[model samples]
Each structure stands twice: as structure tokens, then as C-alpha cells.
Target: MGYNNLCEIGEERIRRAGEKIKSEIEAENAQLTLDSTPKKVPDIGFRVLRVDDSNYEDRRKNVGSYSQADLDFDVDITKSDRSNLDLLFEALPKFQLPYDVRINTLSGDEFDGHTVYSVDDGRLLACFEADIPESLVRAMAAFSPRPSYALVSEHSLPDSAARTNFVEIFKQSADSKTGSTKPYII
Candidate 1:
């Protein structure tokens, strides 16, 4: 499909460009023979993010009219169409984590429906799942090479008691090790 998606066209263009360069180099190498030096093909890659409506309801629009009804209406801060990738990228800068840093989906154990992201293999970790489990919080708090920080969506884990317990786990994890493992709610 023509222009169906950016990734398709982008990769195809890179492949074609590489082929063209290699062919030209081969022709030039024929002239140089023993003097010819190898040409390295540079790596090609991309980072994809979609431009979408704000994840949170437009607070400016709701201002002055803010009320219990508005609060209840705006409970689901994130937009319906915003995917997990979208939320993760949006939260990256919020946590002061670099966007270009490597990140992978955390595996090994399920965390009560939460999706965990381990950045640079635990330089930082984030969980955006709602109603985050205590076990999950503890795991994050104790994760090796302890992240410079961690983040949970304020909307995701709204329970006060659970939040308190999460802070306590951070305290223990911090005590067991030196340095700060910042934990924040976005």
C-alpha cells in the first residue's frame, strides 16, 4: 500500500539507498583494484511516535467549571486511542529519562496487569498499569542497578493506602543500597 505507514516507506527507502551506494562503490573499486578500501554501510533506524490528542482531558477547558462531576468525568485521564507506546513516550520526559535511551518490555513475572518498562536494563523502570500490585512495587523498588528513578501513573494507582505502602517499599529499598532511586507519580 502506498504511504500506508511511515515505517514501510522509510525502510524501503533505506534499502534502496544502500543498494545504490554499494553498486557505485563496486564500480569505483574495479578502477582502484588493490588500492580500494572497504566502505562501511551506516546503520539506519527510526523512533516512531504518533501525534494524537492530549492523553489528559483538556484541563483548561474544564477550568472554572471544575467540580465533582468534572473530576468524575475526567477520571480516565488518558485518551482512548493513546496506545501504551504513546503513554510510555509521553512519560519518558516527564520522568526526566532520555527518549533515545534503550527500553524493553519487562518480563519474568506478571505484575497484576501492569506493563513495566525497563530502561537501559534498569537504569530506570516504570509501571503504567492501573491498581499496581504491592509485589510489583516491591520488585521495582528492589530492581538491581536500581533505577535513577521510577514512575507510576497518578491515575493508575489511585489508592492512598497502596501509595503509602509503595513509599515504604522505596524507603526499604533505598536503605538496602546507597544513592537515590527516585519514585514519582505522573
Candidate 2:
């Protein structure tokens, strides 16, 4: 699918999943508040919900075993309108969302792929697709800080400790090509 199409799909999936979790929480609240259960324990409202790609197996499996991309969705329970339990359920559908990346080269070579990396301190996230040469990889490694994981489209394998360095290098290349200083945040 086209890049725009993929982005749309990802947004829609997140929104739908968010709404579903909201509804479920509302329903449970209504049930617990019924007159028959008036004497039951008080309900604690939800505070936050966090959804990420790793939460879903199908998405992970679809991207292949070596995929390196991940998505994270977070809903604050303390600030959320739903109860604590609602936040829990709201995070469920996030695992089903789809994410992919496509790379193209001046030589017409292409690479397409996806991933589901979870969030962690000091962990760098990256995705690359292109007909990259060893010289370019070396150049990228030269200035960029090394990351914990690297997902290169051409090779379905993830580089655990050197991803950050390459991503920084690739960002520079992309910036130079696009004639812009803003790095692709995704």
C-alpha cells in the first residue's frame, strides 16, 4: 500500500481501538452501578491506557519474525474519563494495529517491512528501507549514536546494539536529499 494509505490505516485502527475500549469501560461501569449491586464495592476509575505494537501477536507475526518496528498507545487513567479497568481494556486493541515501512533507492531497488518495538529508557527506535551500500552504512555509523535495535528492510534481521548509529547516519542522508533539517520522527 501507499505511504499515505498506510498512515491512514494506522490512525483509523488506533482511533477505533480507543473508542472500543471506551465503550467497554462505560458498559462495565453501568453494570456495576446498577441498583442490584448498589451495596457492592466502590469502583476505582481508570487512569491511563498504553497500547503498543508488541501487544498484538498477529501484527508481530505478520511483519515476520525479524521485524523491528513497534507502536505505543498510552491513555492516562488518572486523567482519563474511564475507570482504571477501562484503561486496561482500552490498551488491548492497540496490539492489533498495523505498521509498515517501505524504502526505495535511486537504482530502483526497494524494501518493504514492519516491526513492533516497545518503549524503554535508552532504547533507540529506527526503521530503514533502501538499496544501501556498505560505504553508506559505514558513513552512517561514523556520526550517529549507536542504538539498541536497528531494523533494516533489506535484511529482515535486527541489529540489537548498532541500530542507533545507523539511524543517525540515515537521517543525515535523508535530510540532505530532502533539503530539510527536520529528521523523519517516525
Candidate 3:
């Protein structure tokens, strides 16, 4: 009953159930009312499951060792083609989120122009944007309802300084909380 497994299975079941109900309604030839369906429906964030390559890039080398200069060069950890949704699905199971957990995308100005995934109503929040900033990190940490777990891509930050700031922001945010437990960062 890991979170990832549950989210996927639950969503599929829901879709199947919806299809079944729709077909049944169609079979009965029920009169349709304009008010029956709303004009606006939220994005449920469902995708067809398929076999794909790993989200991260394979950097393994057979060489016994590398020089300091060689290691100094930057490397992209994630594959270029992977999307936010891809990362989310890969992370869901690892975090052990519930099957019926709710997921919401927080974006626009409120989230500092970042698309953040709020899982189970802030129990876990994840941002996979490539260009993350201190303001965005702070916003996520200070997000209302206080996420117990926060995930950010290491490659999102601009530099080593930003990376250091990312950890410090979360640390400071956790220190301000009432309990001894701090939110887990990934």
C-alpha cells in the first residue's frame, strides 16, 4: 500500500468506474440536462502507463578513477525529456503516499511562478522546475498547512550558493515550527 502504487491504482479505478457509469447512463438513454455537467473540470493529472527509460541520466563509467578537473564539469542528473508528472509518479511510491491521497498543483504568482505538487493536502510538496529560486523554496517551506515532506530537484538551483541557501531556508523554516520533527527534504 505504498503511496505511489495507491495513487496510480486509485486513479485508474476511478477512471474505469467513471467510464462504466457513463456507458450505463448512455445505455439507459436518460435525458441530459445542461446542469448535469459542469463547464470547468479540474485536471486529474492522469497519464497512460507505459514502459520508459529511467528519469535520470546514466553517468556510470568503467574507468577506475577520474581527475579532479574531469569531475568539476557539470552533469545533468535527470533526463531532458522527463516532465514534472514523470518525476511525480516515480517519487510517489518511494514516499509511501496513500492510495486515495489528493494531489493539487499550486502554481501562478502565489507559488512564486513555480509549479509545485501538493500531495495529500500539504503532507508532501514537490517542485521539479529546472530554475528554482530562494523565494520559491521559502514559499514552499512556509506554505500553509506546513508540508511534512518537501522535495526539490538538486539541479534546479542556479549555483552552489543557491543550493546552500535551499537547505538553510528549510532548516530555518523547520526551526520555527512548534514540534521537534522537521520536514524531510529531498
Candidate 4:
């Protein structure tokens, strides 16, 4: 087959796989539902932003303090498929993306705490929570220039032997043009 034909086939396979996983997740969970489907398929992708203490210092001294940003993404799944989504999330570590990553759902919250390890290729993974606030979701979707994915991280030094690093990576996106200079404190 031609390259385009092969590519189309591959995409079809991926779509079928996603559909199958969605079905399985629905079968396992009873509360999940497809609240809204995107009118058009998004350009699904990922981005990574790195913030080391040295970089922060350089930016602060020259470019001002780095701004705090939030990342957002959407998954087409019903409440019933939450379990399957969790399973898929757990399976991401095995893909060998140059990082050992874990996303654990914190108690009393709807989503999980994303923990990244051994990051060599600047990739992190996590699952989405159903109860994300609409305003926050809208804000996250409104990043200027709208990246398919976004990564925000910061570095700090506070009289410690080692510098502190706070990083967040996102897998969904939209177009918002507001900018701020708030620092992420994690």
C-alpha cells in the first residue's frame, strides 16, 4: 500500500483501539457518560516545558519571574469508562518514554497526583478527572497560541542542599490569550 494508505490504516487502527478501550471502560464503570463530544477532532499532541533553578534565576534577573500556567486536555469517555481510563493511565509507564511516570488519584479529589520519574525525553503522563471545574477548564484551554500539549515547571532554592523543581505537563489544549506572572508553588 502507499504511504498515505498505510497512514490511514494506522489511524483507523488507533481509533478502533480507542473505541474498544472506551467500551471496556464503560462496561466496568457505571457513572461515566459522554457529556459532550468535540464538534471537530482536536490536534491531539503533547509539549514539555523545563524549569531549572538556574533558568529561573536567569529569567528573573533578565526576563522577570517565570509565569505560572495550567495545562488541560480532554478525553472522550463516559463515567462508566473511568476504571478503564485508570487502567490505560497505569499502563503508560510501560511504554518507555524516557521517563518513569505515575499518576495517582488523591483521596477526596476527583483526579490523581502525577508523579514523574527518570525523565530523559521530557514526557509526563496522567489521567483526567471528571469533576474539573468548568472555569478552570476554560482557562486552561485558553493558552495563547494554543499548544496541543503544555508543560509548566519551576525551580527554586531555599537554603537547601538541593534545588526544588515543580513541573506540570498537559495533553489537551485551546486558544486563550491572557498571561500572568504567578509562580506555581509545588
Candidate 5:
């Protein structure tokens, strides 16, 4: 292999190892039947992640120069290269969603105009779409089995009215009447 560093080789090796384990598990699972005693299969998989620079761009190079209010203005909040899976992996721990749980993307009709990913029913909802639509905000506010936590891209939501709608929506969604989504956006 013409690899330069350990990271490259390690990533590839890890990927292959996971594939090997999954195949083994599938082969084992194929043997289970109602007539035969079911054997429990231990979960075997890996989540490979890499470290990088901050996804958000700072207008002022110096953090001291920017105030809390400055973030409200125009600034690219998320890096373009970031994908749904990347955001989902990053947000999973933050939102306290478990790695072992399987996550599925919500059907387009579920949120209509917006892409939604769900984990453990609606315990954690991640909306990674940029330029979130108003319809989505309203739908999320009224979301059934209201999400315990939500994550959105920082600059994805550009409209203040939509944000305000979310505030009201969160208030209504919360069983405690706090109406908060406890949202975390990267």
C-alpha cells in the first residue's frame, strides 16, 4: 500500500474489520429459526470518525472582537463538505442518542419540505438541511411523540419568523410547558 500515514491505513483497516464482523454476524443470524433455540448475537460494528477544523466560520479572527449579538448577522455557520451522516454522528453524543441504536431518515411525507432523521422513535430528532422551511418548523413544533432534543445547522435556518415559530412550537411540544426543543445545531 502507498499510504503516507497511520491514519489512512487505520481507517481502511477498521473499515475492513467491520465488514468482516458484519458478515460473520449475518452468517450466524441466518441459522436462527423458530424450531431451533435462538442464539443472541452481540452487536458488532464500528463508527469511524475523523477530527478536523471547526465547521462554523468566524467573521472575526479574534473571538474577543465578536459579541454574542454578532452571531445573529450574516456568516456561514456550517462547512459545505459536511454531510447528513457526519452531522448525525457528531450530534448523536451531544443529543445523548446512543451509538448502538439504529437511526432511519424520516420519509419525506413525515416532515414534508424538510429532511428529518430519527433515533429511538422521536427521542432525538436531527434536521441537517440547510435553509429549513417554515412548514418544517411548524411541523416539528407539533411533532408527535415530541422529540426530547433537536439539532439543526447554525445558518440553515435564516428566517427569524421561523425561529420565532420554533420558540412557540417548542413551548407547546414540551410536556413540562417549558416549550423548549433543547436544540443543538452545528
Candidate 6:
């Protein structure tokens, strides 16, 4: 509320500015005496609203345009420009995850160098990197606290075998943990 200006910018820049402003306010506050604390900054922040094309490609056709050939093949519904983050956020509301839910970006050698987004402290885990490996799927399944949902883009799997392995790894993980199959969304 103390601020006088607002700017709309790219996601990365906004994130950086938010971090910078938070730190600067904290530093300034730390220097203030008890009496001067009255002049301290108020709770300040920014909300990000991304305006862009839909994450999915439009594959719909008129009733008369639907041909038998269309039924024989698969089509990728995701648009080419959509990033993993875009798809991840788009899925949040569909799953009814809270808007304020915490999302952690995880990437390390342990995850096989793939970026994984841990939602609500691993209650929901999502990875959209291409050519996702079996090891990464297993790692996600083995996440601490055990995610209730494990999500990955269909196109991320290199082949049918990888997709099968992904399901199996999570299924086995659930089975071992609960001594039965648990309802884990994937």
C-alpha cells in the first residue's frame, strides 16, 4: 500500500522483483529502532496473472468434418509454445488445488537432473520434461511424505514402455506403502 507504482512484466522479471523487494524491506526493517519501527513497510506483494494462449491445441472439428481417419490416430493436444509451468498451473484448478498452495521446484542429481514441481509439500508432484525416464518416475514415487498425485505429460514418455514403467513404479510404491493399492492420481 505504501508503493506508488506498479508494473506488468514477464514472469521471471516479476519473480526477481518480488524477491528483491522482500529482501530490501527486511533489511530496512532490521535497521529500524523500536520507536522507528512505526515507519516500517506494510505487508506488500504482487499477484501474477499470466495472459497467454491456451496450453492445449484446438483439435476439435465440426461434426461433418470428423472422418474415420481422425479416429484411427492420436493427436497431441498441447500447444507448442506452452512450457511445463504453464501446463502445471493450468492443471492446478482442474484438480481443485488451492490457489495459495505451495509449489516447490526441485532439481538435482538425485532427480536425474530433471525439474520436478512438488505441490502442497509433495501432495501433488508434476514433471513435464520431455523424454522422462523410468528412474525419474521412480524418484517421484519415492518422494518423502508420498505424493497423492503424480503427474507427467503424456508426451514426456519416450515410448510405451516408459509409460508402462511409470505406472508400475507408482503402483508398486503405493502398494508397498499401504499394503494395498492406494488411490493415487497419475
Please tell me which predicted candidate would have the highest lDDT against the true structure: 6
Q: Tell me the TM-score of model 5.
A: 0.66
Task: List the candidate 2 regions with Cα displacement exceeding 4 Å.
Answer: 1-127, 155-186
Candidate 3 vs candidate 4: which has greater TM-score?
3
Off by over 4 Å in 1: 4-11, 15-45, 60-73, 110-114
Which of 5 and 6 is the better model by lDDT? 6
How much lDDT does candidate 4 score? 0.31
Comparing 5 and 6 on TM-score, the stronger one: 6
TM-score of each: 0.69, 0.20, 0.68, 0.20, 0.66, 0.67
Report how far off residue 157 is in candidate 2 (Å).
10
Task: State the C-alpha lDDT per candidate.
Answer: 0.73, 0.35, 0.72, 0.31, 0.69, 0.74
**Candidate 2: minimum summed lDDT over ten consecutive residues — where?**
103-112
Off by over 4 Å in 5: 1-34, 37-44, 61-75, 88-102, 176-180, 184-186
**Tens digit of lDDT per residue, candidate 2, span 1-186?**
444766567666766676776677667767774455433333333222244332222332344444333332211112323332332233323432222222122121221122222213212223333234444454322323332332333221234233454456555554342331221211
Of candidate 1, the 10-residue stretch with the lowest lDDT total is 41-50
**Count of backbone collisions in candidate 3:** 3
For all candidates, the clash counts are 0, 21, 3, 11, 2, 0
Candidate 3: tens digits of C-alpha lDDT, residues 1-186 = 444776688787888777776666665455557557533333344555666777887667656666655555534577778888787777777789844568889999978778999988888889887778778888887888887778877667767688777777777877444532243433
Candidate 1 lDDT tens digits, 1-96: 677777879878877787887778767766765865866544444465556666666655636778878776665677767766677788777667
In angstroms, give how far residue 93 of model 4 lies from its true place: 7.5
Error of 6 at 66 (Å): 8.2
Worst 10 residues of 4 by lDDT: 159-168
Candidate 1 or 6, higher TM-score? 1
